[model samples]
Target chain A: MKFKTLVRPLLVATAAVGATAVAQPAAKPSPEGVATAAQNVIIDRALLTAFKALPSRFEDAKNPITAEKVELGRMLYFDTRLSKNQDLSCNSCHDLNTFGVDNKPTSTGHKKQLGGRNSPTVYNAGGHTTQFWDGRAANLEEQAKGPILNPVEMAMPSADHVVATIKSIPGYVTAFQKSFPGEADPVTYDNLAKAIGAFERQLVTPSRFDKFLGGDDKALTQVEKAGLKTFLDQGCQTCHYGPALGGSLQKLGLVVPYQAKDQGRFDLTKKESDRMVFRVPTLRNVAKTGPWFHDGSITELQTAVKLMAQHQLGKQLTDTDAKQILAFLDSLTGELPKGYIAKPKLPPSGPKTPKPDPT
Target chain B: MKFKTLVRPLLVATAAVGATAVAQPAAKPSPEGVATAAQNVIIDRALLTAFKALPSRFEDAKNPITAEKVELGRMLYFDTRLSKNQDLSCNSCHDLNTFGVDNKPTSTGHKKQLGGRNSPTVYNAGGHTTQFWDGRAANLEEQAKGPILNPVEMAMPSADHVVATIKSIPGYVTAFQKSFPGEADPVTYDNLAKAIGAFERQLVTPSRFDKFLGGDDKALTQVEKAGLKTFLDQGCQTCHYGPALGGSLQKLGLVVPYQAKDQGRFDLTKKESDRMVFRVPTLRNVAKTGPWFHDGSITELQTAVKLMAQHQLGKQLTDTDAKQILAFLDSLTGELPKGYIAKPKLPPSGPKTPKPDPT
Candidate 1:
C-alpha cells in the first residue's frame, strides 16, 4: 500500500514511554478523572527498517587501517606546516573538537581567504559515496589531496613541496617508513594523503538514533519518534535514507526551483542537466554543524527544513511540522571519539626545512 | 540525480573480470590481433552506498541468544514429537541444508495437508521488519507460535497441551529451567518460543555481496556486478534494499494489477487499500529457496524476474537484462551455518508423554 494510505493504520496512538517529564502537548482526563501525563506517539517499529545502525567504522580493504598509519595520519592532520605559511591544517577547517566543522558559513583558508562552499563535517564522511558539494573526489584519499593544493585553501605549491615538508620533519620520515613498510620511497604525497585519509576514515560517531535503530525503542522520546514519522512521511528520506541519512547526490531544486547563483555540479560538469545538482549532505551531526546548505545561506535549521520540503518535494511544511522534524534531527547529534581525535604533538622541523613563505 | 539519467555516465562499459573460458557474447580482437580476455563492466562504487554488509547476527536485547537456549532450540527444531502426528518438525518445512526451505511450492503439514502459501526461507529472517507474508506476527518469537496450534500445521490441540507435552519430558523440563533461570516453572509455551526465536536470531548467512559492499571491488564477478547495476538501474532496490535486500511490506503489482485469487493482507485487515499488500520477502538465499512467489507458482527464476518487473515496476525486461539480473541474484546465495543448523539428537520421551494422535 502507498505510505499515505497506511499512515493511520500503521501508527498506534498511545501514551509515550519515558515522556512524563515532557510538557504535555495534548493531555486528556484519565478514567480516574485526573489530568493525564504527556502523551507519546507510537509508529509501527517496522517502518524503521529503512535505516541501519552506523557501523563501528567504515572499513576499506584497499587502505588497511593500522595503528602505525593512523598515528602518522593523526599527526599530519594536526600539523599546519603542510600549508605554505604553516598556518592551516586539515583540522583548522574540519575541527575535531567541534564535531569536525569550524561552524563557519564558509571556511577561512590560506591568507584568511574564504572558501566558496560550506565545509561539511568530516565525521562519518568515510561512509559517504563521494566528497564535496559537487562530488568531484571519489573517496577520502582523493578528497584529502584537493584542499592542500587549492590556492584559496592550504596553498601548497605542488605535491613535491608537500612531500619535502614531510621529509624534512625527521620524525614524520621515520613514521612514514613504519606506516608504509618495505616501500622504496615512503615519504611521497600519495602516502601523506593515504595516512590522513586512514585517520579520517575511522572518524565515526555513534548517536542516540543508532541506539533506536539497534532495537531500543526507549532510546528516543515519543516526540522524537513522531518527528521521525513526520520526516519519513514528508519524503525527506527519498534523498536522506541510509546509515549516514544522506549521501547520494540529488537535484537541489527537484520540484520547485530556488533562487541560486551557484550552478552546483553544472559549474564542474558544464552539462545543463547537472545544473543545481549537489551531494545530499549527511544528517549525522547536522544539529551541531549548522549555518546550513551549500552556500550556508540558511542559519536556522527550521528554515532549511521548510525550504527543502518546498524545493525538493513540492510540499509545504507547517511550522509545527518543521519543529517536530528538528526535534528528530536533534537526536542525530552523536558522541565524538574523544581519545581518537585528540591533537597529537607534532615532530620538530629540521634545519633544512623550507622557511614559511608569506607569498 | 535521477538514476536513469546517471546510468550511462555512472557505468563504465569494460570487459568482464574473471570471465575467461566462459563463452563470450561479443568478443572483439585486440590491437595485437589476439582475442581479448573476458571483459568486466564497472559501475561507480558510490552507487553501492545504498547497500550495507549484513551483521554477524541480528541482535535483540529483549531475547538474548545464549548457548543453553540455542542448544534447547536446536533440539526443539528437530524434534518431531512436537507435532500431533510425531511425523514432522520445524525442519520438515524449513530444511536447514537446503537454505531453510523445503523446495516445495507449499509445505505439507498435519494429515499431509498443504499450506496455503509458499514456505519462505528462515535464513536471515531475524533481520526482517515483520514475520510472515501478511505480517501477522511481529517478531520471530511471535511467529514461532502460529503453526504449532494451526489445525493444518503441527496441529497440537492447545498451548497448554504443548506445555504439558514438554513438561512430561524430563530433558526438556531441565533444559527450559536452565535456559530461563530463576523461573519457578519454565516449560511454558512463551519460553519455548523464546528459545526457538533465540536460535533463529543467529541464523544469518554472509554472502559475497557483503564482501563487495565492504569495499572489495573484486568480490563479485564482472557479470554479477553489471547485473547489480542493472538491478539498481531498474529501481528494484526501492522495495529490495537494506542489509536483507528486502524486509519491508510493499504493495504487490504496484504498477500493473496481478491476476490473483488471494487478497493478501486485505483478508486480515479487511481494508480496501491493503488489497494486494504483502511483506516483501528477503532476497537472501532466494536463489536456493525456490519455486518462488507467495504460492510458489512461478518455478523458473527468469520467469519470476520478468513477471516482477512487468507487474510491480511496469517495465518489460529484455531476456538479456533478466539473465544479467539472475547472475546478480546468484551472488546473494549465502553460506549456510552448517555447524549451527546441524540437527541435534532429541532427548528421550518420558513415560507419561502423550502418544501421537492420528485422528
Candidate 2:
C-alpha cells in the first residue's frame, strides 16, 4: 500500500497556481544552464553544509527492524478493521500509494469527520524532529498510537478494544507472537504501534535531490540546479535542511505572524514561545503533498512559495523566483521502492475477530 | 470506510457459537471415523457430478485478459483516489488481502455512509453466473462499475468523474495506452471497469476442496468427507453445484418466507419470479466473510449454516451435522496468491488531475 506516486499537481489549488503567470517560468535561460559562477559556488556550499542525501531507511532506536515485524506492520497498515467503522486503517489517511497522504486539505476521519489539520506525508517522516504538525508526539511510534484512539480518526473504542481485536484474528495472534518473541502475551497495543512504526521507517524516499547531495553534479537538470541556488540564497534552508530537508522545528510565521484556527505547538505546550511554532515539514515530497501549509489552505506551489517567503522569510519572491523554486521542488519527487511498498496480503479474520461497529 | 469484518465467531458472537453444542459436536462416534459404506459412495458420486476443482483463472469474453491490463487493474483496485473522498477504492469493499471482502455485514462507504447489504467475497466472484446479490449485472466487468458510482459505496459522483480522476494520473495515461493499444482514448469509463474486471479474474483461491475435486481423495480429511456427504444429501448442492460451489440463483425463502428489509432480486428486476431470489453466493470464502445473508443479519457461521438449512432447504440441521459440515467448509480455506494481489504502485496524479471534493 505504500508505493503510490505522490505527485499531486491534480490538487485543485495546483490548477489555480498553474493559471498564474508564474505557472511556467519565463526566465531568460534555464536556472541550471545559466547559473553564474558565484551562484554555482553558493549552491554547492549550501547543499554540503545543510543537507544530506536521504537514506533508503530510517532506523528507530526503541523498536529494532526485522523482516517479520515489517511484514506484520504492512498488514496492519492496510487492515481497515483497525477503525471503529472498519473502514479506515493507517493507510486511509497516510496512504502509501499517494505519497502517504489522502491529499485532502484536512483528512476525513471516522464517520467522515474532518480533522483540524492536514495530514503530513508518511514518506520520509521517520527523520522528523517530531511527528504531527504540533509535534505533540515524540516519535512515529508514539504518533501511531494517537489516531486509533482519536474520536475523529480510526476511532477504536479503547486500547483494550484494539488489543482484543488483534487477539481475535488468530493470524495476527501468531504474527504478533512472531514479531515480538520472548513475550508471553505479544499482541499488546504498544507492540501494534511499534510494528506500524517499523514499517513506516522503511518509507524513506530518496529523490534526485538526494543524488545531488551525494555529489552527483549531473543528477539534477540545469533549471533544477539554478532553482537550488535560489532556494538557498533565499534562506529557505535555515529550518528546511537535513536528509529529509526539514526535520527541525520552526515558527510557522517566522519573520511575520500568521493566524489560523490551530495555534500550532501552542496548543500542545500552551507556552507563548510555542505559539505558531510547528516542526518544520520535510520538503521531500512537498509538490505531491499540497494544499500546503499547516492548514493545507494553499494548493498552488507558487502561492505557497510566495506565502512562505513573505511570512517566514520576510521577502517577496518574484514570479521567476517562485517558478525556479517550484522546479527545484520538482526534483524532490522520488522513485517509489517497487516491491517494498507493495500491499501485503492481510490475514483472514479469525472466528473470534471483532465485528465492525458502525455506531 | 470501516464497515467490515463482522466475523461473529472471532467476534464475541463467535464465542457464543463456539460455546454452542456444535462447538463440541458430540456424536456417538465421529462422523469422519465411522462413515457408512453408503455414505462414502454418495459423497464420492455427488462431488464428481456436481463439483469441479476451482480453476486458476476465469476467462472473460468481452474484456480479454492480459498481463498489462491486469497489472493496471490491480493498481486501480487499491487506489482510493477513484472515490469522491479519495478515501474509498475498490479495495475498500472487496479487499484482496482479506479474501476479497471487507467482511462487513454491510460495508461502510464515503463519509462513513452505510450500505444495506453484506459485501460478498470477490475471491471467486468471476465464476458466478452474475454479479451482486440480486444478479443485477451480467458479469464481473459490469459489476465492477457499480460500487464506484453507488452513492452509498465508493460514492464516485459519476463514471466520468472516475475516468477523469484516472486520467489525471500521468502514469495511467501510459498504462491505459499500453494496456489497450491502437485505441484513440484508452482511459474511458468502460475500460476502467474492464481493467478492474481483468484483475478480479485472477482472484481465484484454490483450496483443499479443489484438490479433492481434482480427484485427490486423501485431500479430504475423514470429517471433511462426511461433511461433503451431508452437504449433498441435504440438497444444498442443487443451487450450489459449480466450480464456485454456489453460482446458481436460489430463492431466499424456498421452504418458508424470510423477512428482511431488502427483498433480494426483486429490487433489481422487479419481476415476481425473481422476488425473494438472489444469486446463490459462492461458498469459497464463506467462513472468512461473515455477517452472512444479504442484509448481513447473521454473523455466526454455525447459525448461518443452520438458517440456510431451515429457510432454504426446509431441513433442521442438528448440532452434529452443522459441526461436521463446518469442518468440511474449513477445507475450503485456500492459499492467497502470493504476489498476484499485491497492491500495485499507482501512477502519480498529474497536473490535470481533479481535486478531491469532500462534499
Candidate 3:
C-alpha cells in the first residue's frame, strides 16, 4: 500500500480512540455525518488555538535588522573556528536548506558526544518570547552566549578568551570595530551574541499560508481551505493565531491531560504552576519540522492533531478532519532566501613545507 | 613591574627546562646568533613543503567554484535548527572568524555538556592524509558522516531519518536535485555529507607563508625569517616537513619520555604499533587554532613549542627560538573569501497570537 493509504487508516484508528474517550450521556453521534462534523470541529479548534499563539514580527529594537550587521553575523555564524574544535559550525544544525534544522533528535559537539535537547530553528525565532524550550534566557542576546560557554555546546572557556581569540584575527577585529565602534572591547562576548542575534533576526521566510492569511484566496487549495475552516472552528486559532504562530510560552497540559518526564520551565522557575510549561513552538514550518515536540516523541502531524483535540479541546476528531488540518499546516511552508542555497567559502590552504634533504 | 619585565624572567626559567631535556654533547653559541639561524631553516623547509601540496593549478575540476553550492552550504552551516534541542550548530564550535576554531579546550553539545577533545580547524582539512586526531577517517566524505551519525556529534538517529527530515523542506529538495540529479533519493544522508564535504574542500587557505614558499622573499618579516632558520637547524622539520605541516600520523612520545592515557590509533586499529599514534596537524593558521594537540593539554604557544622540542625533536629551544617560531606560525593566517560574509534571511513573522488566548 502507498504511504498515505497506510497513514489514513492509522489516523482513523487513533480518531476512534479519541471518540471512545469523549463518549458522554449529554450528546452522542447517532449518524456518520454528525460524527464527522463533530470530529472536524474538535480538530480545527485545537490546531487554530495553537497557531494563534505566535508573534507577528522581529521585536528587538536595539539591534534591528541592518544589512551590515546581518552580513557580518552570517559569516560569524558559519565560521567553524568559533568552537574549541574546528569541526562544527552553526550550519551543522539549523541548516537553512533543511528549513533551519539538522534533522537530528539531539546534537553532538566538540568530541562527537550527544547533547540533551533538540536544536530549534532560528527561522522565526526573532518572534519568540524567550529562547529555549525551558525559557532559561529572556532574549536572543542572552540565549546566544549560553551555548558558546556551555562545555557541551561550543565549549568556549571565558569571555576574555573569546575576545582575545577574535582579536588575533585581523579580519574579525576589523568587522567588530566596524560593527560596534568605540567600545573598549568590540569583540567581547556580548557583542558577539548581539551580532549573531541580529543576524538571526533577519531569517524571515514568508509562506503560502501568509499569502492566504493576507487575503489571497487562491493561495490555498480547496482541501487546505477546508482545513483552514476546520482549524478555526475547533478553536486552534486561540493559541496559534499570531504572525509567527506559537512563539509564546504556555503550559503544555493546559487543555491536555498528558504529563512529560521533563519538568520544562519548572526546573528554571521552581514553581509548581510552571511544571511542564514550554515555549510554544512556531508552526510556520510545522509540516517540515518533525519528529515533533521538545522530546521529539510525536512523529506524525496527524497523530499530534488528534491528541490535541481529545486532550486539549476535550473533543474527538476524525481522520478526515485531521488530514485537512495537516494540509493547512503544510501550506505554512515558505520560500527560502535567494542566496540561501549556496555553499560557504572554505578557509585558505597555507604554504607547503619542503621535504627533508637526505645527506 | 611592567608585564614584559615580569614575564621575561619567567620565560628564561622555562627555557632552562627545555635546556636540561635536550642538550647537545658539545654546544657553542654562534656569533651570528644561534636562534636566528635555526629559525630560517625551519621556515624555509615548511614553506617549500606547503607549496608542493597544492593541486596542480591547471588540473580541470568538474565541480568548480559556484555561487549556488557555496551559498547553500553556507546557509546550512549557520542554521541551528539541525540539532534535537534547536540550540547548537556547526558554528557553535568551528567558528571561521575565530580562526576556524572557538579556542575552547573542549566543545559543548546538547545541554551544556562537555565533549571529549579540542575541535580541530576545518581549514585545509582537504589536504590532510586523514581526518581527526586519531586519523580515523580516510577522507572528508567518511569524516563528514562520522559527526552526523556519532552519538556525541550531530547525534542523528539514522541517515534515512536525516533524508526524510530534509525532504520535507521544499527548497532543499530543489537544491538537492540541482546538486545531485538522477538519484532515487537526492537528499539522503550520504549526499548531505557529500555536499557539506564539497564545501569543506573549498576551505583551502592561502597564507603569506604560502607566498614566501611560492618564492616571494618579501612575504615574511625578518623575525619570521629568523624563526624559520631555527625551526630547521634544531631538527624541527624532521616530522613536521609536509604539505599539511604535520597531517601525517606519528607517535606522540618521539623524544621525551611521557605516557598518555589515549592509545590513539591503536584504539581504532587494535594494532600495538599504532598506540599513541596521531595525525600531525597542519600548521596553517596554527596561531589562531589552539589550545594545541590531541588532548589540548598546552595553552600557550611558547609552552607547546618547548614541549615539542624536548619530546618530539629531542632538542632544547631557546626563548628567542620559540618567539621566532611563533612569528613564522602567525604568518600562516589568511583572509577569507570575498563576500563570504552574508546576511541570513529569517522566517517571516506571522500574525500575533496572544500568550493565553482561550479562543
Residue A36 alpha-carbon offset, candidate 3, angstroms: 81
Candidate that would win on TM-score: 1
Chain B alone, TM-score, model 2: 0.88
Question: What is the Cα-based lDDT of residue B72 in candidate 2?
Answer: 90
Candidate 2 docking: what grade?
incorrect
**Residue range B31-66, candidate 2, lDDT tens digits:** 333344114432433124346678879996788999
lDDT of 2 by residue, A145-189 (tens): 999999999989899999988988889999999999999989999
Candidate 3 residue-wise lDDT at A7? 33
Relative to the unseen true structure, what is the C-alpha lDDT of residue B8 in candidate 1, on a scale of 0 to 100? 21
Question: What are the root-mean-square deviations of the candidates from the true structure over C-alphas?
Answer: 11.4, 30.8, 33.2
A1-359 in candidate 1: lDDT tens per residue?
A: 11222112211111211233121121222222111111455555545655668898888888999889999999999988988988899999999999899889999888899999999999999877778998888789889999999999999999999998888889999999999999999999889989999998889899999998888888888768767866765556656766788776665754334446777776887644346767889999898998889988778888888777655544456566777788899999999998877789999999988888779
Q: Which structure among the candidates has the greatest lDDT? A: 1
lDDT of 1 at A193: 88
Question: What is the fnat of model 3 with respect to the true interface contacts?
Answer: 0.00
User: Candidate 1 — which pairs collide?
Assistant: A16-A40, A250-B1, B15-B39, B15-B40, B16-B39, B16-B40, B17-B40
